[model samples]
Target: MKRLKYIMWYTGLLAISACSSERIAPDGETEQNIDVHLAAGISESDNSSRSDNNTYIKTAFTTNDEIRLVNTVFFNTPDFTNENTIFTYAGIENNKYKFTQSSQNDTSGNPDGTGSTDDTQPIGITWNDFSPTSFVYMFEAVYYPGNELFSSVPSDQSNVENFKKADLLIAHHRMPLEDRYKDIELTFHHAFAMVKVEATVPTGVGGLPKNAIQEASMINVQTAYHVDYTATIQNNGLRTVKGIEDENYPRTNVKMWLQSITENTAKKTQTYTFLGIIPVPNPNDPNEPIIVQDDFIHFEVKVDDKTTKTYRFVPKENAIHLEQAHITVLKLQLGKNGVLPLLLSAEIAPWTQASAGMILDEEDPTDNTLSGGNSSDDQQGGNQSENQQGGTEP
Candidate 1:
């Protein structure tokens, strides 16, 4: 898979490191940059080939000035180990100094003293507290810097599994002591999935006047979740997720004013498309990650205050859990016909994944703009932070 690249250095970074280090290059070689290829997706899907639409792959370095060498999956020992060799700082010297990935495994994270040449191992590089091991450093991250509270309550919200969407990118691994290894490769899994909704209002329906002004606005929208997404990471990579509410978004039913149905300038045709993040899961058993139902999305029409109709939107599928790094969409179709039963078709794929007859909604704020580059990065960062803030006092 082709590695997604984001060369620009960004600020407001929150890395999951332990302590700071005093190790800086005595020589002037600190300027030479180390190459890090980021694979932020599941292994099943070729991250190399993932399109930007299906995924939002970006980089938040260990620090703005320093690239900390972390102990990840390929480091050393067992099905799930949590001993990190934190290289708070280091500078790569000659090709002889290196960090590498090997097919072999040794408890002692030291380079094979046997002087055997293996392809996966790195050659000619060294760092502080570096250890050579055959273990693979598997990495998965869900970066929800803002508007991401794990648990809140109208009912006992405190015990309700307080999961704070990591304000920073929390990269997990055991730190290896100063050792030499080879080339670096990191794969990232999407901690959360997303879905977008679009409501279609065909003209000449809902007992409206025949002046081509038929439109529907989705108000009081709620993307309720039954499962707590902010799970605690266990030593073995498995998560300890407790049932919790979205503390930041206590009101599941917010207004989807952005996706309201509307007509063209001539006020003739009804727009048939829309988008959104993946809805919350309806977990069948609270203890397990298995989902038995779709997240709830209920809303009323916002265009006309005189019209009072509430619509319930549910995923087409029963189970709704995020596919690591992948997106599961909920496409909605509505009309006065009533016989169609308010259909929602859910499909999982890259961000651009869609089905036949589903029109791309024009209501997206990020439309025509890259999720990473452009001015969207700053705007998105601001929005994330804003979402976490408590509502202003009345």
Candidate 2:
């Protein structure tokens, strides 16, 4: 068994340490500059075990990963807006994850063994004409693949590589800026729900062959998602995941990609696991019950090398409700009784960061006008997995 991997694209803590100083401006006015030092990786808090071996699998951030920070500094001023700050993960140095400002003009001074061999430096965040004791009320952290924050969610996420990029994570926080030397830990949460289906069958006496399963998928699922901070957003939760309104969005079939196949001879059953990521439902009331409608699990099985059969399973009402940052797992038993739901679990855990080896290595992601700079870095950590479900009408 390869162990359950790709639980989520990103789920971990990002520790940003800052040192403060005062620099005199050309007008002889004092300005506060905070030099950011990056020390980020997966902590022991996010851990999970394999069911068979009880071992752990860790995932980490890859080189060139760019994170965007949008802060709304609250002051007594009448006019106020948000400032977008960008940083790129530039490999490890001095046992700390080195991050550099994406700005091409920033050069590292190599102080305290913090600079990488590439001469990259952590960017300084400066506040001009304001008291260093000011406080920032709203801080938004967003990570999009290639470091590009798309105005809208992509219509397609079928490909694992594209899915990895589209696995958007966002975090919102209210922190005091009085402690300029304090480390700001931004914890990102997934903006979408994950659905994983496992199909199983007994191998003998009226049971199908081990190779019977051919393909599996979810039918009539929401394929597109759109989220924005411009709308009313809660302090901790993500903005409601609104489906992208387009001909290709809000409706499509998502093919469940196979992750692993395992056989338990002692149990006399073989299981096929397939997983897919879906957009969370958008309800008018946050507390209202989520109801799934007209959705179905469609599967194909080979009766023999020359014969194939198709089957579908419609979920009973109240069996599943999808929520952002949560995962639902559905298990089906293939037998003479048709496809029947065997095990259904919901919200086992919010989807977390990616497993090992899925990291992207490309650097210099295209600049979003909101922020800029370029660099890269890498790390090692594990993803938490759980025995973690869907319903459709046939």
Candidate 3:
């Protein structure tokens, strides 16, 4: 209904009819300050916690972009004319960081004495200044502020074509405007699912010339990636929303090209690559908890400008969660013969946590043997590479 209404409006069918509406705003001294804090959470099974999850120059570095806060009402009904939303500063500090800004006696300063704690905020919210009824706020880290939840893809933006990528993410959190003037901890779940593709051709694939496997480009992958929420205010003052990515609806018109992450120029072997993170709405039924499930992940791999192999995988069971930038890896082994019966396996993991995320099962040293498996290691995902190095999961 949300999407349809927008389409009608854009097509010049729906126009505002005469209606009287009530508008309210917070008044002087009605505000109270609340501190915001963040905590890093990842799946236990996610080994790519802080390592191979695309760190600076390395894998796994802290996010430095400032976080954005919007009035909950704005997302439910976006109105630039609505002055209800306010942000404290240029940007919130990156995760596990401290506020470097000079402190002021203003209530926006740290209510709790500033400490070098990861995600502990020195700032407070001037709560009373905002709309008393507009209690909930939307927290997210998008490419830019003022991005529409279900808007169209700009021609110049990354997701518009195969050349650029769109990683814009928004984790809609509707927190109650509580009277408690203390620290309020909010968890920003990922509104987008990470789709990582690890495609491999056996050592001696007969179908292609040697140079063909050296370079591969992803032509395009299509899906309905944009979404919106119609939240219901809960008893706890928190709003519960069902995130819908109706594939049957018109395409979000979003496209993605595979990002080659493990192309070894030295060995001339194309191992693995990433399919940039595009929006995939949480398909959870409002009644049940949010668990991303049954979404079709599809892709077409073109090697050396030829041998385009297309594959689709729908997670049979619970898939990767749309949380904290976690990712679900789909490994497609396009057989040595480059024929039908593609061997594919799925693995769910968090970014920056898994060490062997791109490491193929056949090439993984953790394997006890080929054509055979170990029960213990199998349960551990068959790769103890991180364990062997005495590495810790962040």
Best by TM-score: 2
The weakest ten consecutive residues by lDDT in model 3 span 354-363
lDDT of 2 by residue, 188-290 (tens): 6667766677777666544566767777666555556665655545545555565443564545666666666899899778898776666764544556434
Which one wins by TM-score: 2 or 3?
2
Most lDDT-accurate candidate = 2
RMSD of each: 21.9, 21.4, 20.8
Q: Name model 2 segments beyond 4 Å from true.
A: 1-59, 73-85, 91-98, 104-137, 146-163, 180-183, 228-239, 248-250, 283-292, 336-347, 352-394
For each of the candidates, give the backbone clash count.
Answer: 52, 26, 17
Evaluate residue 335 in candidate 3 and report its C-alpha lDDT on the 0 to 100 scale: 42
Which candidate would rank higher by lDDT, 1 or 2?
2
> By TM-score, highest first, what's the ranking?
2, 3, 1
Cα lDDT for residue 101, model 3? 23
lDDT of 1: 0.32
Candidate 3: RMSD over Cα atoms? Answer: 20.8
Question: Which TM-score value belongs to model 3?
Answer: 0.45
Candidate 1 C-alpha lDDT tens digits along 1-394: 1232232222212221211222343456555333322222223344344232332333222221122234333432221112132212122223111222221222244375544455354432233333333433333322233324333212211111211121122233322323123234333333333334554443343412222222222222223433322443542242222222355543332222233346654533354343333233334357643333223444443323353333334333223454433455556544342212344566777522333222111122445321221233222223322112222111
The superposed Cα distance between candidate 1 and the true structure at residue 169, in angstroms, equals 7.4
What TM-score against the true fold does each predicted structure earn? 0.40, 0.60, 0.45
